[model samples]
Target: MEENTFKKGLIDGLPIGIGYFSVAFAFGIFALRCGLKGWQAVAISATNLTSAGQIAAVPIIAVQGSLVELASTQLVINMRYFLMSVVLSQKLKPETTVLDKLIIAWCNTDEIFAVCTGKDYRLDKRYCFGILIPPYLGWTLGTLAGVLAGDVLPAIITDSLSIAIYGMLIAVFVPAGENDRNMLMCIAISVALSLCFFYLPYLRELPGGFTIIICAVAASVFMAVKAPVGGDG
Candidate 1:
């Protein structure tokens, strides 16, 4: 049974593994262009897997942002993961161990979490780690390859492939988003708030990364406040 489950995870994970390769390749190219070493780029993606956070940090690093600002920025941007971790913990069985949780947590990107939470996934440690290794390696290798290749590709091709990460984000959100009204509302509110942040003078001038945090938090709080009580339809 466990063997079959692991096989299922691998099969389900294959497409995402390919996409991660391409997207992480873009990150690698940009990182290298910004004067980071290939290994440094690979290490950053492997540990963080937070593309927005990484890209934000790069410019801030270039400008030598203060340590306090960097830490605060990362925390604010990554706060959503705290909510995700809480939801994921609920899906885990009672007997799930500390070691198992630690291993699984390492692969808790948006894509991986979608697979784990859909229906009765019963995601054990072996299945979690199995799904993790291939995609993780693909990301690392793509970064390395991109750095080594170094500017051979034209600008248009790079720009097109840069959308791959956005594609991954849409995939992660759309499925469960259909069934959950709260999630749908949160997404809609976030999008509306994000647009406002982009176009409204003072808000528009706010940094891109900080805008994401503001929209997310505002949308979440709005939903919590507005959710109907006892399915009072």
Candidate 2:
């Protein structure tokens, strides 16, 4: 029996959804640390699924950072989404319309992109929409859980939860680096530059948001020019 494509999307998204819960749970705790109330933390997760952007934004908000800092930081961090959306557009069925594309763009995430692109055939709007449901629910619920837990858990326990987000970041880094030597160099350069921002005099004084923007752009551009993935393929 042929399974429905929508059903296939939901099933495929399940693992990604589960993984997101664990990561989002940690993010919930981190949001609390940044002085966001429980509802605000949950709202952020519900509305925006980009964990890195959330992490970057929450701290800035906590410190009452400038609007320029918030806007520039989020733009730099999330600029990749435009690229990702463009790439995913290529995978849609020929009959897909502008409104359908707009909906897909709203729901797209890194995990969803990986799932949709891993297959060979063109995807319809049904499958694309179906796949996003589980992840969206999991992320929102996880944040809610984290917020509730943060309110009650001892500081010692909540502090221990800090490691989970770092783990999530490493999980993102390792796979790309392992597959491509060039990408590994990019990751290494980004890490080294970030450490300098953390420790070096004068450089350490730069605003956190700009420091991230500079390091990320510098490493990505240096590597892309040096290696030029698939040589313009």
Give the top-scoring candidate (lDDT). Answer: 2
lDDT of 1 at 105: 81
lDDT by residue (47-151, candidate 2, tens digit) is: 889888888899988888999988888887777677668778888888999898877787788778866765567788888888998889888998998888875
Give per-residue lDDT, candidate 2, residue 95.
Answer: 93
TM-scores for candidates 1 onward, in order: 0.84, 0.70
RMSD for each of the candidates: 3.3, 4.3
Looking at model 1, which ten-residue stretch has the lowest summed lDDT? 1-10
* Model 2 weakest 10-residue run by lDDT: 160-169
Displacement of residue 212 (Cα, Å) in model 2 is 10
Tens digits of per-residue lDDT, candidate 1, 1-233, equal: 33425776687677778888887888888888888878888888878877677776766666677988888778867666777788788777677899988877877777777666663545566677677776777777878777777788887887898898778778778875697888898899999999999999899987776688789879888888898436422
RMSD of 1: 3.3
